[model samples]
Target: MVGQAQAVAAPRHHEQSHLRGLVEVAGASVLWGTGGLALQLIREHEPMSPITISAWRMATAAVVLLLALLALRRGPELVHLARTRPRQLLVVGVGTAAYQGFYFVSVTQVGVAVSTVVSLGLAPVLLTVVESVRQRRAPTPGRLAVLATALLGLVLVSVAGHASSTGPDPVLGVVLAVASGTTYALTALAGGSISRETSPLVLTSGMTLVGAAVLLPLLAVVDGPRVSADPVALAWLAYLGVLTMALAYVLLYSGLRVVAPSTAVTASLVEPVTAAVVAAVVLSESLGPAAVAGIVLVLLAVAGLGRPSAAAGPVLPDPGR
Candidate 1:
């Protein structure tokens, strides 16, 4: 009776952990989806380069997270991470900064859906290829099929009238979006490599600070400070920095504690979905039937990324920075 009772309790606890993981990952995704909308709001209020917004978003997040580290009495851990894993942290920070700059600039050029979908959708595929190379084996048939489908979806999105009349040049925009995806893949890989040793919160906080440090020169030299005093824009920037950067990442690392990495990736797919729906409804951006079809295909391909890994357990990494 005792043995049976213990077994039952173990499964029950596992189930609860899985449920909690779902909520955290989903919440993170939802919050992340809001970033593009927030940036749009800022662009509405003032005309500034997206790089400027990216710099400030990271800078503000770095300050908030640093203060948070001090408040939590984990300042020493942060220092330790910087000293020991400085190289890894550099990769994380640069990858973080690069992806955001590329994604945001692409967003302004291509509008939300094309930029968001293409950039987010390609990361998993690129990761898959790199993984296949590392393993010295061809990708499994399922993964190959999924990767092919995703590539097709990307092509369809490009051909299906991605450029808005007022949007940036489409050819250049798609190229940047691809670059953004590559950077995101690298960031995810860097995050996963260091995932075991550090507190997710501390690691994330450190990355933000490093990213800010790296980008500060560019922001100061080229962009200068364009922060607006309008309460409305300030409010949105606060949300992007606080909620999207700080809180979303915290929730991600928290969820990663209990959940499998693959599950987290699947849950976070809600971001592009949320972006597409919100953009269509709120921004009055019309996606043609082909684009809609392409979006669905991309979603399907992304779903393929969540399938259980043979031994490595799903490579879809990154606590979604």
Candidate 2:
């Protein structure tokens, strides 16, 4: 009886791994959610150019990733990947920069609430569309329904919310948010393929380096390449690079090891939730009824998106069994 009880209490390997994946991904989400607030705080305290922040974010993240790889004795592998997979690495890097750049600008424009909602909220759907196209099939009816619902929610939030008093121009903000989502979707596509070929750390590190290269000139042109030496500003940049960029990806890759791909993506929905909550509490940004409804609709669609469609046929018991 004791042995049976112990066996029953212990989770099977798959179940245990899945649970751990959930926890790891959830931790990543929380860290990512802190992103909006972090950026806002940086903007307030650091008051540097947007491009400068973007350049530093990617550059520092790349450096930190390199250091990590060196410590782990994978520096050679990282270099080999950069040399061999230059094009793929470039795509990931540019996409990373574009998404981050767009998101930060969107946050400035519309406050964390709307940017988080539109940018993060829209990525899954965009990814779904891209995947469906890549598979050379139209999205199933369920997917279409989810997309429609999510689109409606996006429109609702965009049209209904009042301009945040301290936020940037809503028109430009919404555009930037959508662009951010688009870039994120594209990045995931490229990053996913690259990640399959190499470890996540190396892929992220390479991409960040490439991203830094691509953003360097842009940063110079955007705000004349300014970086503050204030300890407080450095502190924020460090948190952004080390925690949000580097550590978050480490957790993400760790979670991906044990989680089903779709399930992992679904779990990432927590990021938007975290960002929204943090924005509300820390930034005093409030969503109106329509915006709240939009968020719910988008989340519902995301949940649906994560579920495998049963359009083909139901599973049947084996004849031999």
Summarize candidate 1's per-residue lDDT along 1-321 as a digit string, tens digits: 999998887656655555665577668888887777888898788665678777778888888998989999999999999899999999988988888888877766777557766787677666666766777887667766766666666555545644542365877777888999888877766676676568878987998898888777676655534768877877887788888988887787666655544345445566755566567888987778876876687567655544533211233323332
lDDT of 2 by residue, 67-116 (tens): 98999999988889988888888887888788888987887787765776
TM per candidate comes to 0.76, 0.72
Runs in model 2 with CA error above 4 Å? 1-27, 106-122, 140-178, 252-269, 283-321
Q: What is the C-alpha lDDT of each candidate?
A: 0.71, 0.68
* Deviation in Å, model 1, residue 106 alpha carbon: 4.2
lDDT of 1 at 192: 62
Error of 2 at 251 (Å): 3.9
Q: Worst ten-residue run, lDDT, model 1?
A: 309-318
